[model samples]
Target chain A: MHEWALVDAVASAAETAAEQEKLKKVDAVVVVLGELQNVDRAAARRLFAELRKTKKKALHRARLEIRAEKAVFRCRACGKTFGLRDLNKLSHKESEAVHFLPEMAHVYTECPACASRDFEIARGRGIYVREIRGER
Target chain B: MTDPRVFSIGMRLSKVRRIIAVTGWKGGIGKSSIACALALALAKAGLKTGLLDADFTGASCHVILGARRSFPKEIEGLEPPLVAGVKFMSASFFSGGRAVALRGEEITQSLLEIFCVTQWRELDYLIIDLPPGISDASLDIIRLVPRAEMLVVTTPSVLAEETLRRSLKLFRAMRIPVAGTVMNMADRNGRAVGDKPLDRVPFDSGYEKTLGNPRALAASKLFKAVARLAAKLDAGMVRN
Candidate 1:
């Protein structure tokens, strides 16, 4: 369900990029999905393949590559940034909460060293289309 | 020149140049009302403006603008319907007065759907009415549109200030440009916390009764302040 939207948004963005670059065909689209959001690479690829077969044949020759990014957060108090791998130090309850409910991430997350509740999500919060490689 | 980095991975970029989100830390503080007024004010000022009700659960922009459910034409994709001088879209148009029961993936998908499919004309500003609280929907909006500026709404109560602080911190910590604060439902003692008051919208029964009328918005004090703020934003005179 979520992959369709991601694929649609990515495909549309590629269209605008394609038009601007005067490209006749798109070669490959690389999508880097954030761990924080709910999206699967297989689902995204399946959707992309289906979309290419539709009326938007401009993407017929294009290949889809989906990559995952590790979720990261930056502490506001100490200004230290850490990734999900650091969560091994967290209590099981806190880690589970973050893994299940992404919106409640702030509630579970705190600076490991300083125990600061204040932190800005430095990365892994947004889905990015890293590159749209096409042939002119 | 359009930067490739600015676009979301697969998002079809619309012509809407500037996107502004009106939000509050808590609910029932008139976030939707001010968002509507600001968009209407900009439209009234001869600028092409569009308003999207991102409050998927509580879609009331249609009611505020006195607009009925309209099926917007899909030129190449979905579009926000033009209503009451502001090109607007709300969940009510899709749900048909029924409650929308959407979970995590559904919510994110719906938002992404709107972003990818919506066809927008060239516009000066696009105002979004965000749901109260730091929900997943709101965070995605911030992440989805990285260039978007934020406008916070709050009442003058101490409780409101306490909650507003968290929101202010989130924006500040994330390095998002906060346009300014509008003290909605403020009295004489009502003050915007942390941030300077860009405008004060007092609780008025007169304004309440005329909410759905576009003609009445033209003379509203709220509209004047938002319009002035819009002018400042357009001129790049951001508040410190």
Candidate 2:
């Protein structure tokens, strides 16, 4: 699953942080999953668990905690803020396309209020490392 | 918050030997065509090559390579589909023939995501079809892929050459490596730029008909000129 790739990125970031912070053991890695990307949390967690086995000892003890963030968009034309549910429903194919590349939302969805494609993704884009707790 | 995708980009392209960012200063300079033809040429020469259509808004490498719009197989990461013996990846695969309207930041996000998720195999050459002009995609490639060598493309027109000079100045200022400049759609008496070796790709009138047909494209004179350019790049690689 593509979640495996995102989880791999999380692992890599945590490892880099550990090395930079001179961490002896990484205790927890907080990863934020944006709703727009629609990454499967269960798959990400499972993959992170499997990935830890092959990673260094510093990351082996690291706990992967994924937090969800709701998608928000703001229409640049009318300055109307909206959520994913507020917009017209996207087709299965369109949603899948957005899942692969979150920017595809611009192609598939538009401003619910003004119907302008020039809407900014105000928040909740994609996966990122929120925090990495470790024993330095 | 740290973007984890940044860390994985290096790991994703760790196996790629040479990353060539094929770019031009102006649109309609045949940058995409050169990138596609070069990728095909390299692959035909038995070098494992990959072509990433990084022009998110104006992705046409898929069309040039005659690749169908389909999702790449998910195997740990997205594996680029092999088109005409060249592994190809593009946003067109996801956009599905629709226009991808994205701002500069969105373009950067998409580019980073593509680099982070697309798992490139051990490639001798990875040719990236960058959008025309020096913009977010070009700068992002420079920052994200520091090892990338820029293969500037220009035409014989004075207007194209002026922009080419400006782009070359910027690349030089950034200390980016220039593989060489390609004078695409050159006239018979077109003079090469500066002291650089002549890498002129003559304008083939039949090039338009070869679009979306890889067989005809490979047999075209455009492909022949690009193949020669590919050979020169290969030799340079060996020397380096």
Q: lDDT for each of the candidates? A: 0.70, 0.90
Interface RMSD of each: 10.4, 0.6
DockQ of predicted model 2: 0.91
lDDT by residue (tens digit), candidate 1, B153-206: 888888778877887888889998788777887789976566455467777657
Worst 10 residues of 1 chain B by lDDT: B1-10
Question: Which parts of model 2 have CA positions greater than 4 angstroms off?
Answer: B237-240
Q: Summing lDDT over every window of 10 consecutive residues in candidate 1 chain A, give the lowest-scoring window.
A: A95-104
Q: Compared to the true structure, candidate 2 yields what TM-score? A: 0.98
TM-score of chain A of 1: 0.77
True contacts kept of each: 0.05, 0.90
Task: Find the candidate with the highest TM-score and give its number.
Answer: 2
Worst 10 residues of 2 chain B by lDDT: B189-198
| lDDT computed for candidate 2 | 0.90
Error of 1 at B6 (Å): 12
Per-residue C-alpha lDDT of model 2 across residues A29-79, encoded as one tens digit per residue: 998899999999888888898897777789997888889999999999999
